[model samples]
Target chain A: MTADDGFDETLFELALRMGDNALILGQRVSAWCGHAPVLEEDIAMANVGLDLIGQTKLWLGLAGEIEGKGRSADDLAFLRADRAFRNCLLVEQPNVDYAHTLMRQYLFDAWHLPMLTALKQSAEPRVAEIAEKSAKEAAYHLERSSDLVIRLGDGSVESHERMQAALNALWPFTGEFVAPDDVDKAAASRGLGPDLSAIAERYNETTAAVLRDATLSAPADAPVRKGGKEGLHSEHLGYLLSEMQWLQRSHPGAQW
Target chain B: MTAAGTLPSEKDIWRWLEDVPDPEIPVVSVVDLGIVRDVAVDKGGAVVTVTPTYSGCPATAVIAMEIETALRKKGLDPVRLETRLSPAWTTDWISDEGRSKLKEYGIAPPVQGTSCAGAMKQANATVACPRCGSENTEEISRFGSTPCKASWRCRDCLEPFDHFKSF
Candidate 1:
């Protein structure tokens, strides 16, 4: 299913993986619309979701072209089954509360900004172009999430405890950020993208500094959870995909 | 009309595009926003290359349709709209006239050079109030009503306004 006629399958997987992360997380974030703690937060969350969904289109559009399939961004986003998704486990986790949502966003942005920055120099011209554009938005996202993580994590005792708990719960899935298998290694070796492991140090440093400021501790000796990168997602992803794909499934090609 | 078979000059085509106001900010034309990167007239038709202001801006489609509709009404049939991403769109590209129009419309124009990494680092850049001309404006939120803007309020005037994001 991953093979492509003219394009490298590794590149297609890379693009699909990137697109799926953005699409799933965007959908998750958008779910917070009208449900955030305050009006400003509600708008802010929706805006961030819009940006991610926008990036998803670029990534998925590139994926479709690489696959040489008639599929489009919409097809890949709304038609794919849960098992077919290539996003890491981190993004598919449930948004249990405001703290969990922010923590997830912060973790993702910390990795996303650096990843896109590295991908800006991708050997693939298209990848580089998309990365260049995406990195800017990612930077903005990271800046916002980092600030919030610090504010809420260090704010009140209740807020601090919630943030700490959220961090502890979410940290395990982060192991997937660096668990690059054969596909990632091949992409990195070919200069199509950066090595995931190489990006790990940077992600750790960035998140560490922000966590320190937030008065949160990284869970030491946390079990490393992997496999989402390999299309083995947590059960939460099935629920997310079911709801996200419902409209598309009910009325295929439904549009205004 | 120049002639039945003759095509309009690129400059003339640009002028026609200026008539296409941005669907979100109708005060400024797409050309004024500097999104209409290049206009090329060929035997086929006029191809207007546009760069999106934001990755997920919903106005992108509307703007494309508006451009096509405006051009087609001018008898320029088969207008091809192309999306360009390189050298990504920035508020710095907002023409001087566009900046002025934004202020006149009660929107704060982005500070020059804020699109770069240096300025992005400073999350709370002081923006002069569009309504009161007070530099005592505070950012209410980074994300605003539109993708390309941020919400801000003037301390002096107490009037909330949208600031076109540095991006």
Candidate 2:
């Protein structure tokens, strides 16, 4: 494909994948806005969620820009139907317990930090710029989430059990993150993305260390699910999109 | 309006902006916050490009308005403000002079370093205590009065201070 063929389809698809992850994770985290176990934690989670939403806006906006469509970030986020989103199933999972939330964050942050670090050197300047800015925020989120996992994993018997369960439950979804697709291969070859296979190694080391410090055992190897990077998502995405798009679909360009 | 060859210069416009303090941190001017990335004149009017300290920072709107107000007061009727997020705002963009001014005004400036360092390194970085000029300060909380700052307390002065976290 020629560079002038408009926005690179592969790049646009990659941007959507990145944007979807942020959007779905932001939605899941936002659910804890008023229900956090502690006030400080409530605010912290909400703040982190807001930061992710801001990131989603930027990435999604770039996606729209690449597509050369008239759609704005808001339109893409709230108007898109299910099966169109490219986010991993892990992000779309419901926020069941505080332990679940922390586990999800820890798992995702471990991968995100390295991914952004690599993207900072992307051939595309805009992608590199966004990655540079976002890497800093992701680092902080990873630190806080890692600390939480350790605390809960080593806490009272009941808390330790709960966190361990959370870790085990979410482990199955972790494989989907590093399962590369053709789009990912294309971007990686161009120096615009990370080699997920390599990232998986770093992710394993970091996550294992955190788990060990928390007195939790890492889950054994499991068959990984695939296709999220290609617009194939889990059942949860349909419900999420339905709720998120209700207002936008009903109103159709209605602005506040 | 001044005659074609007799108009005031860019320095005059910058001097006029001296009174425009940052909305969130009143001690420092918008220019000092490093938000004012560029200032130039176009055919229509004066154009100023600003990068917010963070995305969704509430102070952004107020800063834009203040810039417009300040320019209008200086007889620049047509002032345009643009916000850019591409390069992303870093606390390193803040000038050393601005850091000193923040200290003098009772606000701790952001510490210098790359964000890849873990939280422990971030917390241990020397942030001069706003009150007693002590280096024996500890971060009390990562989240502070606003999204941009962290609360710290000095071992010597025993007073809590807000350290603007580097974005």
Candidate 3:
């Protein structure tokens, strides 16, 4: 039998989800390349995007190897349909402004830092390896984003308002990241994936502390909104894919 | 350097690696920068395992080539190379001599005693000037000429320099 013939699909699905989060978030953050408020901010955001894309490449490469597919990382990244993407809706959302980008990054980085740290002990050596590396990068990412959240939130009235608004708008989607599901459950049972819920408390504690220091409060509460894990995404993802994949789709197998 | 039909020992292999300088920062060797992960000596040849400083750092390909060429020139044939992504390369891996060399080269080394994740909560440490040894430096940008560095300027020295990022 082939690698996928008799194996449980949860591992592949989990890996896809992990990669999609990084890839889509990378694209979103990269959108600010030329538009950032200052040169230093521009360079910083680009560095963050580069790190995310690098992590994506590693996760997808492992996914392809485990599936025994002839497909390489590029094929998986450029050839997939928008519906097939498993990234969170939060990552695919448009970058409305610098505050929005920072808030989104702050939320995700908090979750990513701890999740990757715990995943370093995964049963799958490849997964553990990827996590070990990503945890380091994610740490730096968290540091930058968290620092910005505090700076902007406490800087001026307008800046604080913008950051607060972004937090309110994005709060609902943060829930899905730590929400338990069957795939995550199976991975947790096999010791291949860390329980995201257990890590959620840590993520929450960290985010709350930053928010307090920033002089801005998180949204009081919101319903747990989710969908991207099941190949479902916001309308924004379709447009993003069209823009990202246009060149590749227009000319099949084109090389730089 | 080796003579014809004679195998190089582990000592010779490591010495050759130490002589191979980093492609981007030629001031330091790969071993001093801590990218050379493993050097395994076999009967016929040696296998070297390296970890790239960053995944997409352009210098990595050049690094692999430099390692091979350095070994090949020493009469070592078929020196196999492998890249490891796990336990990602950290600035903490830089040797004490490497740190001193970086300072002499006008680049501030990473702050000691900080890991990637914990770096977030730790308040900014004093970044001393490599040229004047002053603790008055302000980071200009989080990224610099290379993936592993940040751009900073010293208030006292009035000179811009690259600070090797902690991660």
Candidate 4:
């Protein structure tokens, strides 16, 4: 839903991208609530999910305001179809295994931390405010995820192989993080958001260092897979939406 | 014991708020945790400003309701609660008394001097054990039971404890 009709469509799209990314990933992480490999890890995953969900409120709340459609964060999150979501494909990838889940989180956190750090200096005050608060949490998330990546990637043969395979499978989806389209270009030109290319450069350096430390090798010049930003998602997103929106869709206005 | 028709002074309101315990950490008051940023009372009503310690802290709403209820019990009608995001809450804001209370309650207080901006960089910062008073503590996990805490264990006593995170 591009904000045509004279509204700041760039801001709306950028906010939606940020909000949707967090919402989808948060939902995925929250799925591990009672099913983690260990008790401590279960608690940790849930905490991360909670933090991301909390951030979704801030980002989507701003999106709704810019859209001027009287939509709240809940309405945007629970009611939107897969085609309406603006999150990158990386986050929407299924958590195939614990290693895959950790890799996905590490990859997203690597981009997310730098993205939020730059947004702290956003031209929009509301965006900057949310970024300031969110950056701290993102930093913590990155620290934990990167640490796990290093540990598991360098662990025993089985664990190392698992981590390596997960990295290879998820690597292609990361291209969308830095791949700029018209919306990203407009947002950067207007100074409403950070330049995706600059953030991409930082993302490469960060992920490279972490992968090196983890003893994991990524495919060089891997084919870039994109399109989630423009809402063309994988089959996985539809399943994710069905489960996440079931309660709200089945019985509208349901609340605890 | 304020006189009828006379609003309690801000100092008095602050004092009464000290008795309102945090829902999660009942041993410490919200004021002790630095959640209540400001309080003002006028003839119209009372307004209390609060900042959530974590973006996803579930206790935020409950803390607001508790504050309003505590104020209402004091005969302060038409109380208003405001949420402020700037000057994001930090463990540094936690009062000295809060730190001591947390320690006594078996949760290690955050190490002083760690800036919230550089929180992620201070991953290896030393945290003393509240159980055995040992400085040899190892972090079990960065994410703890609550958003503001981390799980740490003392080498000497070998007892697991929660450390109030620096951010």
Candidate 5:
């Protein structure tokens, strides 16, 4: 509990942002249910999605509790509008192909590892609890994606080119993870969140190592894209929200 | 007070829980699987602390309901199942009994001391076959029939088996 009410809201909002990333990405992964390249991969990826959605429940569950609005995790996940979402744009982007999916996963896993590791020391016990729990899963996910990236990038002509292209297109989105903003400032000043600067360095270094192993070159530095946290997102997020929320909206209060 | 028998002791409740088999693996009990982390009889009621095998295993709800059903069947009033996920559930928590049961039931038990992330780098990590007891085995797939197990086949016996993933 902070003395400042505004700070508390920012903290809660931060949780929402974090949860949105997991939920949206998980949803995207789930869409690959029967369509993954292979049967084993289908199961593995869906399991990964399931883990993320489970984590989403924990984060949004806590956020709902903190907000004290009588809303449940499902309420927060299903009822929220596109403009209200605060996930990083990378997560909400369409899964163009396996290459893009793996690339985006690898990138986020890089950030997720350090950010969650640092968050294990959060002032809020609940935040720390979720962080501690999430870090293990995050590590394994990174391992899988990291291994895949290497295999795909170094595998064959077709795979290598596809992976390289995916990396090139997605690298810019990694910037928003550590870029400081209002929520970052509030969380950092109060020791409620990770020190983003240190995590930023680790994330970049980790990504570089993985890319090197994959024999892929980092994309040339360019203007970094931003603003999913502030609720301004690309056109992709709207369509994603429409599909995700369609059932909830069409059949209000529907429960299995 | 509602005409059921007297409440069982915490120890007795734990013993009672041993009869409730896991919904997925019917050969092993939930307590043996380590999902029922703690059981207590407090002034308020009986509180059973649980940690699920994996975060997303659909079996969690079924296991919780089975726990409550068993408790109610025994007349334990106001039962509470609290999910504690901090330390997280790992294969190491599977009781010795659970491991043996898994093997006898045609599943290779998880290799302890290796975390799931540790196996991630080496996805096809070798394991002994439950049927042939041969160490020369290869993972058929990283994912098995269930979320917790990996499909493996023994080279020597040429028989397929399931290895409980340690994640």
Candidate 6:
């Protein structure tokens, strides 16, 4: 197929990455809908989840539109198999504890802020538009997560230990965020994506500062896992997709 | 008591809606916020579809009421307002003309690249003062009175202004 007729698999992959991140994270957040550490935090987490779900819908819808397929956002999100998902391993990880969730959010938000900033200047107007809008919400998510991390890290001996442990556990997965893949390079060449390497540096600095403020040390770097962008995900993704897609698969085209 | 020539069309309903200012901004109308997504008319009544700027935005209820009220006052008593959340709302939906109007209303419009990372940079970057049109401005706080705004102070004019959050 000529370049014009040829599908841009790279762009499609990038969109899937974004959509999966939002969808998975949103699902995790929604788990705390009626059960938060506090009432205010409960509402706050729910609001954040709502924002993420909204973002997921937009990204998935765009993905469908770009693919020129008849698949709707629901089809892309709730009808796909686990191996077909492109979400990061970090997002798919379970929300073990409040500290764990906060740590994961802090790390993800730290990386996402810079990545979205770069994406706002994307050559693709749709991607840029979504990035521009999402960046604002991500800023709030980062701030709130930062505040929680600092509080937990400095609160009590147990709290501090838990927060530190969470940080250590999550550190390895972070390496995947900055490591550029074929999709990243392709989008960067077309100005439709951000330079992940530059974003990585900024992410490291910002996250390091936050950890330092919380009296927590950064975890040592470890081997990074790849393949999420290639539709290869962790074992946890199968369970997630099964749950998310069960209703859609069971009752085809069912609507509330 | 109809004081007009004929019944308003869907487009006319939207045009008349121009007079309904946003309850919060007052200066900017709902149309400018991109909240008024679509307007349609049928034999039963007119349907005005609006998507909330934010999911938890308290202004949505008021805006819906305002739309119904405004239409009713124009003798469209059976006006129906619907809310849609599927596509989601984005600040990019705000038009250039709308941004200018927001600026003129003394509310510092959200900058072009208003993402979280960009906003953090904005906290340190030089922002034009809404009052004096100077580039000397400092962020007072990231969280403003509402979730949708940020507080800033201009050094030249020494006046505090609200910058609409870019989201």
Best by TM-score: 1
After superposition, the stretches of candidate 6 with alpha carbons farther than 4 Å from their true spots are A1-4, B1-52, B55-167
Better by DockQ, candidate 5 or 2: 5
Question: What TM-score number comes out for model 6?
Answer: 0.71
Please provide, for model 5 over B14-115, each residue's C-alpha lDDT reduced to its tens digit, 9 standing for 90 to 100. Answer: 998999999989999998888887899966368999987777788999999999988887777788899997777778888999999999999999877677
Q: What is the TM-score of chain A in candidate 5?
A: 0.97
lDDT tens digits by residue: candidate 5, A33-152: 999999878988898898899889989998888787788999999999888888999998789999999999999999988898898999888899888888888887887788899999
Judge the docking of candidate 6 as incorrect, acceptable, medium or high: incorrect
- lDDT against the true structure, per candidate, is 0.90, 0.81, 0.85, 0.90, 0.86, 0.79
Once model 3 is optimally superposed onto the true structure by TM-score, how far is the C-alpha of residue B43 displaced, in angstroms?
5.8
Give the TM-scores of the predictions, in the order they appear: 0.97, 0.89, 0.92, 0.96, 0.94, 0.71
Candidate 5, residue B30: the lDDT equals: 91
lDDT of 6: 0.79
Report the C-alpha lDDT of model 3 over A76-188, residue by residue, as the tens digit: 88999988898888899889988999999999998998888888999988889888888888877787788889999999999999999999999889988898788888889
Predicted structure 1, TM vs. truth: 0.97
Ranking by DockQ: 1, 4, 5, 3, 2, 6
TM-score of chain A of each: 0.97, 0.96, 0.96, 0.97, 0.97, 0.96
* TM-score of decoy 2: 0.89
lDDT of 1 by residue, A1-256 (tens): 2343556888999899888889889999999999999988899999999989999999999999988868999998999887889999999999999999999999999999989999999999999999889888998888889989999999999999999999999999887877778998899989998988779999999888999999999999999988887889899999998898999999998997
Give the clashing pairs for model 4: none
Q: What is the lDDT of residue B120 in candidate 6?
A: 44
Number of clashes in every candidate structure? 0, 0, 0, 0, 0, 2
Clashing pairs in model 5, backbone N/Cα/C closer than 3 A: none
Q: Please, what are the lDDT tens digits per residue for candidate 4 over residues A121-205?
A: 8888889888888888998888889999999999999999999999999999998999889988887777777889899999999
Ten-residue stretch with the least lDDT total in model 3 chain A: A1-10
